[model samples]
Structures are given as C-alpha cells and as structure tokens.
Target: MCVGDGILPPGPLSGAVGGKVKFNTTLSPPTKPFLSVSWTFKGVNIITSTSVNVTSPGHTNRITLDRATGALELRSLVLGDSGEYSVSIIQDGGQQTQGNTTLNVYEDISGASITGSDDVLIEGQSSTNLTCDATGSISTREWMKDGQPLQPSDRVTFFENNRMVSISPVNISDNGQYLCQLSNPFSFAEASYGLAVNYGPGAVTILGPATATVDTLVVLYCSARTFSPAAFTWFFNGLQKDVDEAGYVIEKASYSHSGNYTCRAFNDVIDKHATASYSMQIKGRLAQRDTGSQDRGQQGHQMTPTPTTSRAPGQRAPDAPDTPTTSDAPGQSK
Candidate 1:
C-alpha cells in the first residue's frame, strides 16, 4: 500500500520507453509539515523536493518529488531506468516513512510483419517457413488463419520463441489469409499474410454432344480442379487447335466438325498437364438416315394388280358356262 501503510507492496510497475508514469504514493501533507522528501533508484538518489537530481544524469529533467504528498513522477522514461525505486519522507515532528517498488521498462512495439522462406508456396510437395518480425521487445506471439486460432499439429510447428512457424508438406487447405499478433506489457502489434498453396490441374474433363447434325449449333466445354486457373488447349483428331479456353463453340457444324476433340488442362504452378477427349460425328442431314430405297420399291409394285390364272382356249371352260345349260343339268339320261 502506497497510502496509509506507506509501503508500495514491492510490486513491479509497467512503463514503455518515451512515456510518463506517476508513482502515486497517495500521501498528503502531514499536520506537522515536512522536513524533506527524496526519491532514489537502486539505492542512489534521483530527485529531491527541491527539484534537484544527483547521481543519475539521465533523470536530471525527468524526475519530480512532492514534499507534502511523498508522490514522485517520472517522464521521458528509457529502458535503462528499470530497477528498484524507493521514496522517503520525513516530517518536522521527526516522523518518517519509506515506500519501495520495482519498475519494468519496455520498448514500444511497431512495424509487425511476416516473412516466408519462399515467395511461392506449392501444395503437397513443398515446405515453407514463416517468421514473424517486429521492431521492439515482444513477449508473446499468437498465430491465426482465416480468423481462427492456429495450433501446432503434426504438419505445423513453432520454434525460435514462437516467432517462426514451419509447415511441412503443405496441403490445399492451407491456402488462406494468415495473421500474426505480437504483444508485450506496453504495446501490441499485428501483421497479415496471404498463404497461397498451389495445387493441381487434375481430373480433366470434357463435356459436349457425341453427335450433332450438320448446320447445327454445337458447343463443347472443359473443366478441371486446380488451385489456380488452368490453361486450356483444344485438339481435333490429335491436332492442336488454335483455341485456348474452357469452351469451344461451333455455331454452325459442318463436315469439317466431324472428328475427335480433345481438351488439355495445364497448371503452371505445378507444371503439370491433363487431357480428355470427345468423339463427335456430323451428317449432311438427319433425313439421310431414313430407308428411302425400301419405300421406293413398295411404291413401284403398287401399280400391278393382284395375280390371276388363265387357261388354254381348247381346254373347256372350267366350272361350266356362266349359265348352267340343259345338257349339263343333272345326271338325266340323254
């Protein structure tokens, strides 16, 4: 207690460089008035009630002492000023009390940033090291990925006072925004980095119709899974086409469009390529598939009537004449 007990509990007070701090002793003028009030650092006199500092040249203009209240203020602090401090007050009635405390000075932190071992990070096959950097003293380092706390795992680790992190065998999921937070008793700072983990150009696929009629609109599409956009190359009948896109448009299909089309996908990061092909056929017209010859044969035979049998003139008309004659009437005797 820096008040009635006149003792500062020996607890350390925090301050940053180039800042000001007031050691509130909470003391007031004694009824008997005061004889002298003095402040000391590490057993050496720093300032007196008369505004005079002896022994420490750095505290010449930065120390203040109140004879009445026994309070002391320090200004324009520096790192070298950290240490044990004591204040003694004596009243005219010969009553004296002393207070003791500790001080911890820290340099303010700033310019926090993260640096990686390599400019480009690759997935599944590449290892990367990231180090957090700042200007002044830092006591703690925290890491975050996409706003979530990042913990050490089998593939992720921290070292060098947690100022650096190592990721081995980078994965596709590692791609995200990363942040590093640095802190100390007096200051805090943060920096961000975009972690790009390049992956594949695999699972190449082509989509389109297998057959299209002549003079029809035909469109073919291509796709693949990749971290970065993949470059596409189209091929017709094993020949490289002039187009390089995910879509191939044939607004008007013709005989020339009848061939096997291939789509090749390439990723520059992994330097790998994949391909898929589609077989397309074009006809002059859909009507060409109809059975025209069979239909014509049936029409040619329609003119002829059904077949009829003819007998020789002398052979006698079969089944008798149209009208039954008297001679041919029954089995009567002639």
Candidate 2:
C-alpha cells in the first residue's frame, strides 16, 4: 500500500526461449529533479539506473532500462532466466514505488519418438498400439500416415489428446510409415515409425496339361501372390506327394498317373494358405491298322500266295481267309 501514488500495475509476463520480452512500469519524475530506478531478479540486482547513468555489469549487453518510464527489457531469454522480477523507483524526497512480476519462459519440444506394439502387423489377425513421446512444453499433437492426416475409422482409435493411436484388425491397406507431430506456440517436432502388414498366399493358380498320352512327359506348375513367398506342396489323389517345389514333373506319363492333382500354397508370416486342383487324364497307345490288297488270277489261272502281315506285340493276327486256297485243293492244281 505504500507504493508511490500506486502508479504501476501488478501482473506476470510471458516470454519464449531465445526471444525478447519487456516488463513495463509507469513512474512520475520527482519534483526535485533527481530520480533513481532499480531492477532485481529473485532479489538479486540485475540493473540499476539514475537520471543520467545506468549500470548492469553482469547483463550489460542483454538488459536495458528506460530512464523516463522505469521499464525493463531483456533480450535472448532462456529457461534459467525465468523467475520473479521486482522494480523499485525512488524520488529525491525519499518517496518510493515498487512492483513485482513473474516471468515464464517456454522452450521448444525436442527428441521426439514414436513407438508401436508391433513392427509387423498381420492382416485381420493383429492389433497395434502406437505412442508418441517428446520433451518440452507441447500444446498440440497430430498424426499422419503415408504423408496424409490420419482420420479415425471403425477399426482405428485415438487417445491421450491424439498422442496415442490404436489399430484393430489391421488390413493390407493399413501398412505404411506413420508420423507423430508435436507442436507448441513457439516450436514443433516430428517422429516417424514404419508399419508393415503381413498378408496372404491367396488365389493359388496351377498351370499344366490337363491330358497326356502314355509314355509322354508332363510338368505342372503352382504359384500364388503374397506378401511373403509361400511354400508349395503337391498332392495326388487325396494323398500327399513327396514333391515340395512349385513345379511337379512326371518323367513318363502312364494310365496309373491319371488323377486329381492339388497344389497348396502356405505363408507362415500371415498363417494363411490356399489350394488349387487340376484333373489329369492319361490314354494308352492305339493299335495300328493293316492295309493289304487281295489278288485274283485272270481267266482260270491259279492265285499266287500273299505275304503274311507283321503284327505288333500283344496284337492278334487275323484268321486265315475263309475262301478255298490253291494249296487246300492240291489235286485239282496242275
């Protein structure tokens, strides 16, 4: 209540780190033509001034005072320089005016990091939780995916003022790099995390001949598209075969080889598999036809003998001709 004429108002001031600020005070020049003004930080003298001269050895370059108004100016403020500041003005008649103000300096956020529950997400089987961490007076946060702002969907949720995010039942479309940006009035920082989605071995395809002749060679190929290459297995007639490669070969096809062939593609990363089947048919070789000409002697002449036909193995020869032959009627001949 003893403040000289209660001229200066009382309150606090705000400043940004590595920036400048001013603390204002109003005072009337003393009637005797002699006036003094002094500024103290946490009760330690920072600068002192009179009508004609000003002295602040420790803060000579960064601190200044207004001789007429008793205002204090500070340049390049730092976090350590934040505290209570007091200004006192003395008139030549021993009258004094004093006021105090609190200064708060805020620094920018630094060292931001983003973390997630799983680096590799499995499609339709995995859920992930993500968090953003940083240092400083942060006021707002934003999340981005694939260079675009992330919006909450049926399977995605946000928490902690958007500093944390949750993705449930992840799908193939959810795979990409994610970013977390932390910002304040004075500064901003960002962190990023890579998200991978492990998905199928779906839509298996089999390529091969559907039919083959006996003693002919055949090959069957199986494949599928997947995030991770799938392991292949071949099955024949409801039984597992010894072949594990994507390609199956039959050196020489036989009637016994005809059956339903199946290819199974499995991906371990996503624990998913697909199957495709093909029906194969094998046919036995056909018998060759015999082409021969029958000769009849002209005008009572005896018929000459015809050469016998050569038959393939396992083939039966045609029975002897039913008509009488010259050898059968030997007595009538000659």
> Clashes in each model (backbone N, CA, C under 3 Å)?
0, 0
All models: lDDT?
0.83, 0.83
Best by TM-score: 1
Q: Candidate 2, residues 1-334: lDDT per residue as tens digits? A: 2132354455556678889998876665444643688888898888877745555576778987876677778998888887888888877787777788788787889999998874567889889988999998787899999999999999999998998999998988888899999987678999999888888888899999888889999999998978888999999999999999999999999999999999999998767889999999998887744323122324466567889899999676689566653554656745
List residue ranges in candidate 1 displaced over 4 A. Answer: 1-6, 26-28, 33-38, 48-56, 88-98, 184-186, 236-240, 254-260, 279-334
Model 2: how large is the Cα RMSD against the reference?
A: 12.4
State the weakest 10-residue window (summed lDDT) of model 1.
Answer: 1-10
Q: How far out, in Å, is residue 171 in model 2?
A: 2.6
Backbone clashes (count) for model 2: 0
Residues 1-334, candidate 1: write the lDDT tens digits: 2222454544678889999877877566678656777788899887766343343676767877655677778999888878888888777877788888888789989999999866567777889888999998788999999999988999999999889999998899889888999998989999999888887787888889988989999999999989899999999999998899999999899999999999999998778888998899998774556576766868656564696568887676567667655655577676
